[model samples]
Target: MTGSHGLAAAQKGVQDSGNPTHFNFFRSALRGRQRVLWCANDPTVCLDREKNPWGGSTCCYQRFCKDTMSDPNHCGACGKTCAYGFVCCNGNCVDIQNDARNCGACFEECPGQSRCFYAMCDYGG
Candidate 1:
C-alpha cells in the first residue's frame, strides 16, 4: 500500500471491507507485498543503460550488452575477454587477422612459410 500502484488497491480494499471475504483478502494481501519493477528482468546480474547496477528499478536496460563491443573484459559477451596479444573481432579474439601463430582462429597456427592475410594462410607466398 506504500507504492503508487498499491494505493489504488488499498483504497479499493478499504471501501470493500464491509464484506467479510473482501476484508480478509485485503488483510492477507498486505502481508507479503513489495514494490518491484516487472520489466527490470534479472536485476541481480544485469546493468542498466546508465551503467548502474540494476536492482529491478525502472531506469534503463538497453545498454546491458552494449559494452561488449569495446570492453576487453566482455568483448563479445559478458565475462568474455580477449587473450594476451589478441584483439576482439566481431565477438572473437583474433591476432592480426594474418599472424602465423593465430591465422584464422585463436588456435590455428600456420605451417612452413605461409603468410596469413585476412584469416587465410597464403601458402603460395
Candidate 2:
C-alpha cells in the first residue's frame, strides 16, 4: 500500500459510525464537518474534499475512481485504479491506452509485452 497510487490522504483518523472497520476507505474526505453518505453497509467514496481553485468541490466525481459504484474493478476500492487505463475486460483490469478492444483507451499494449495470440506471441499489431 506504499505505491505512488496509495490512498495517503485517507491515513488521517476519523469517527467510524456503526461499522468502524470499513470507514477507512473514505475517512480522509469526510473530515472537517463534511457530511458523508454511506451506501450499503460500507462505502468507498465519501464526499468531495478536493476544492478547486475557486474553492468549490466537484459534487460529481467522474475522475475520482471511488465514486464508480458499479465498476467492479474500482468499486469499494479506494485509490486503486484499473490498470489498462479504465476498461473492464473479462473481469480483468485493462489499460485501454493499448488494449486490443480499446487500442488507445479500450485496448493498449504494455511496453515490451506481446499480445496473447493463439497461444503464440508477437510484438504488436
Candidate 3:
C-alpha cells in the first residue's frame, strides 16, 4: 500500500475509526470484513515498510518510532524510537559505548565527536 506512516487499517480498507474488530492495543488484530491476519510479533509481516521521504523505501520505518528493524521507543514493541539518542542496538536501539554512530548519543555524544560504528556512532572520548 505505499507503506506510509499513520496509515491506519481504516484508510486501506475500513471506513471507520481504529476500533476494528480484531484490533488490539498490544497486538496486530484483523480489520474490516476482509480480515487478514499475519504474524503479530513482527510489524513487517503486516505493516508495509515505509518509503524514504527522499525516495525509494527506507531501511527502517518513516519515523524511527515505527520501524520494526531498529526502533527503541517501541523496542520490539510499537511506535517506538531507539530510546532517545540511541539507535537500534541488538534488535533494539540501545546505547552503544563503542558505537561510533551512537557512541556519545548513548554515553556522552556530540556531533563529529563520534564515528558511525556499523552505521551507529562511537563517541568514546
Candidate 4:
C-alpha cells in the first residue's frame, strides 16, 4: 500500500493508551501483508519519522507537538504567550517597538512614504 494509505489505515485502527498524548495502532496482516505498528507519543518514531521526516523537529506541549521556536502562541516555550500586537522573533516575543516592517503591531507594515518610530505606524520620512 502507499504510504498515505498505510497511514490512513493505521490511524483508523489506533487505540488509546490511557494517556491523552499516547496512542497505539495495531494492524493485523491482511492477505499476507505484514503487521503495522504505530506509536503516537513517540517523537522519534511518530513525529520525526512520519510527521516531520524532513524537519525532524518537534516539541511536546499539552499532549501536542509544536515548534516553539517560531510558533507565536507558544514562542520559546509552551504556554509562553505573545501579546496580540507582538510576534515570535527568533524564539522571543516582540512588539513592533522599533521594527519598520511591523510598525505598531504584528504584520502591520509602515507605508513607504513614512517610517516607523516608537511603535507607531507612521513617523518621520
Candidate 5:
C-alpha cells in the first residue's frame, strides 16, 4: 500500500506453502501486517540524528529541512525570525537590549570604561 505522505507498506511474515493452519495464520496476520518506509528525499519529513546522515536532527520548514537552533531565519522554531542587526545565538536572537557590544543598537559598542545598561551605554562608576 502507498500513502500520499510518501509512505509505503509491505507485508512482513512467513510465506504460506500448503499447510492449512499456516495459511490461515498467514492470512490473519496479513490483515494487520504493515511496514512503513521513511524516505530521506521527502523534504517534509523530519529526521533525527540517527536517521539523518547529514548531522543533527532537523525540522520541516517551508518545505525544507532546517536546524532552528542556529538558523537566523527560523531561530528556535519554524518561521521564527531574528531582527535586523541581531544575531542568532543558541536559537535566540542576541545583540540587543543591554548587550555591551550592541548597546542601544546593533554593533553600537560601549566606549572605554563604560558598559551597557538598559540598552544604553553607561559611562559612570
Candidate 6:
C-alpha cells in the first residue's frame, strides 16, 4: 500500500460534491497516518502548501506548472514557452534530434536531399 495501492485508496475515499472541490493530503507524524482536508471552491489554495499556501485560483494552474523542468509553457521559469514539436531540455527548448524542420538549431531545416539524423543533416543515400 505504498504506491498505486495507496493512491487508489485515496481516490476511492474522495467525495463527489459537484461544486469544484479541492483536497489536500498531509502526512502526519504518526507512521502510516495521513490527514485529508477538503476545501470549498476557493482560488487561493494549492496542492502543495510550500509552493503556494494562498494565492490566485485554480485558473492560475491552468496555464502554470509547478515543475519547470518539463513544462512546455514554463520550461525553466514562468513565461518561457517552447515552440511546437520542440521539447524542454535542461531549461531550454530544443528541437528533436531527427526533426526535419529544426535539425541542430532553431529553424535549421534539412535539405530535400538530406534527412536529419541525431541532430545532423545526413546526406547518405
Q: For every candidate structure, what is the RMSD over all alpha carbons to the true structure, in angstroms? A: 15.8, 14.4, 14.7, 13.6, 17.8, 12.9
Listed in order, each prediction's TM-score against the native is 0.29, 0.23, 0.26, 0.42, 0.41, 0.33
TM-score of candidate 2 on Cα atoms, chains taken together: 0.23
Q: Which runs of model 1 end up more than 4 angstroms from their true locations?
A: 1-66, 97-114, 117-125
Q: How well is each residue in 29-119 modelled by candidate 3, as lDDT tens digits?
A: 2233223333334434345434222111112333232334444644554555564556664346765645653454544343564465543
Model 6 TM-score relative to the real fold: 0.33
Tens-digit lDDT track of model 2 for 1-125: 66654555344433434445556546555563343333333222334344222112212334332333324344334334465435554335655544544344323333454553422234345
lDDT of each residue in 26-58, candidate 1, tens digit only: 666874343223334554343443533332222
Error of 1 at 77 (Å): 1.1
Q: Scored by CA lDDT, what does every candidate get?
A: 0.57, 0.40, 0.44, 0.59, 0.62, 0.55
> Model 2 off-target regions past 4 Å?
1-80, 84-91, 107-125
Clashes in predicted model 3:
23
Candidate 3 runs further than 4 Å off: 1-65, 97-125
Give the winner by lDDT: 2 or 6.
Answer: 6
* Residue 74 in model 3: lDDT: 47
lDDT of 6: 0.55
